[model samples]
Target: MKQHLFHGYMTKNVQKRISEATTAILPSEREMNSGINKARRAMTPTIPTTQLFDIAEPFTKTLHDDDFLIVDKMITRRQRILLFASREQLKMLLGVDTILMDGTFSTCPSVFDQVYTIHAVKYDQSFPCVFGLLPNRLKTTYHFMFQELKSVAMQMQ
Candidate 1:
C-alpha cells in the first residue's frame, strides 16, 4: 500500500507475494482466532453491576453459616470478594495431592479481572475444584487466597 512519487505504486499481487515470502515472526504473533468468540456471544446479555452482585447474593449468604466457604472482600479491590472454596470443593481439594492453578482472562467479563482456577487430580483425572474472580494480580491477593485455602484444609483434617 505504500506509495511514492518516484517509485509509483505497489499492486495487490506484489503485496500478496511479499507477505507470503516473509519468514520473520513477531513476538506477539498468534494464530487466527475463530471459535473463541462464539461462546461469549451465546452467553446471556451482560447484566448490570447491581444484578451481578445480586446473582452472587445467594453464595454470599452461606458465608456466615458455612464453615467451609471463605468469602473476603478486603483481600481484593472494589469489594470484589475472594471466594476461596466451597465445602464440597474443599473436600475434593483436600483429597488430591497434585494441584494445578491457571488464570484465564479471555473468557472473563469486564466486571472482574481474571478467572483464577485451582484444579486437582481426582480419580486419576484433573478437575477444576474451585474458581475465583480476582480484581488484580497482586502478590498479597494470591497469598491471601492460598492462606485461606490452607487454613480451610487444616480445619477439614
Candidate 2:
C-alpha cells in the first residue's frame, strides 16, 4: 500500500483504497479516525494555555485571500469572542437585506461555549458571512457580537 499510495494521504482515502483492495475485510470509520488522531497527536507539539489566545499568522487569514479576522474583543471581564469573515463575505452581508443567525454549542472549541454564525440571503441563496466563537449564550454576548460586527461594517462603508 505504501508503494501505491502517496505519503501523507488522508486516512479516509487510504481506508477506501484498502477496502476496495480487500473486499471482505473493512475497517470501521471510527477506528480509522481514532488511529489517525492518535498519530496526529503524537506528531504535533503541545501548546501552553497562555499561547492559545495568540492566534498564529497562518490561521489569522483566509485561505485564498487576505485577513479574515473581523473582530477580537472581550464583551465582559471573563468572556472573549473571536469573529472571522473575509472582506468579500462582509461586503455580501452588507449588500443583502435579510440575514439569518444561529448558534451551535456542540462543535465549538472547549474554551468557547457556542459557535454563532450569521448568514445573508441574496438571489435566493444564503451565504455565511460571519463565524464567531462566543464564550456564552447570554443576551449581552449576542448584543456585543452584533455591535462589533456593525462597527466593522460601518467602517467598511
Candidate 3:
C-alpha cells in the first residue's frame, strides 16, 4: 500500500482506495480499523498512564516553522499545568493593559480539567496570547499560571 495515502486521509478513504486498487479479498471495515489503530499506537510515543507524562519532542514546538511553543510547565501538589505561547504572543500580551481571561472545561483533553486562555486586545481586536491546560480551578492554580507567565514575559523584555 502507498504510505502517503495513510498519512492524512481518513480511515474510510484509505480503506476504499486500497480496496479499489486490488482484486483480492480485503478485510472487513472493523478489522481494517483495528489494524489502523494498532499501527497508529505503535508509531506514537508511549504516554504515561497517569497525569505526569512529559511532553514528547514532537509536540514541543510548532510543526510548520519549528518555533518554540511551550512557555511553562508547572507541577503543584494537586495538579500539572502546561502553558503554551510564542514569544511574540507573550510580548503582545504584556504590551496591552486590558487583557481578557477565560476558562473552558468542555473542550480540554481527558488528562486536564480546564483550558484557560488569555487574550490581548490590540486595536479593538482580541487575539489569544496564552493557552493553559490546567488540572483544576483552584485559586492556587490561577496564581501559579499567572506568576509563571509573568516570569516568562519579564525574561523576554
Cα shift from native, residue 157, model 2 (Å): 1.7
lDDT of 2 by residue, 49-80 (tens): 43147776766798885889878887766678
Specify the poorest-scoring 10-residue window by lDDT in model 3: 65-74
Name the best candidate (by lDDT). 2
Off by over 4 Å in 1: 1-69, 76-79
Candidate scoring better on lDDT of 1 and 3: 3
Q: Model 1: how far is 105 from its true place, Å? A: 0.7
The order of the candidates by lDDT, greatest first, is: 2, 3, 1
Superposed Cα deviation of residue 141, candidate 3 (Å): 0.8
TM-score: model 1 vs. ground truth? 0.55
- Computed on alpha carbons, the lDDT of every model, listed in order, comes to 0.65, 0.83, 0.79
Clashes of 1: 0
Over 4 Å off, model 2: 1-52
Runs off by more than 4 Å, candidate 3: 1-48, 63-74
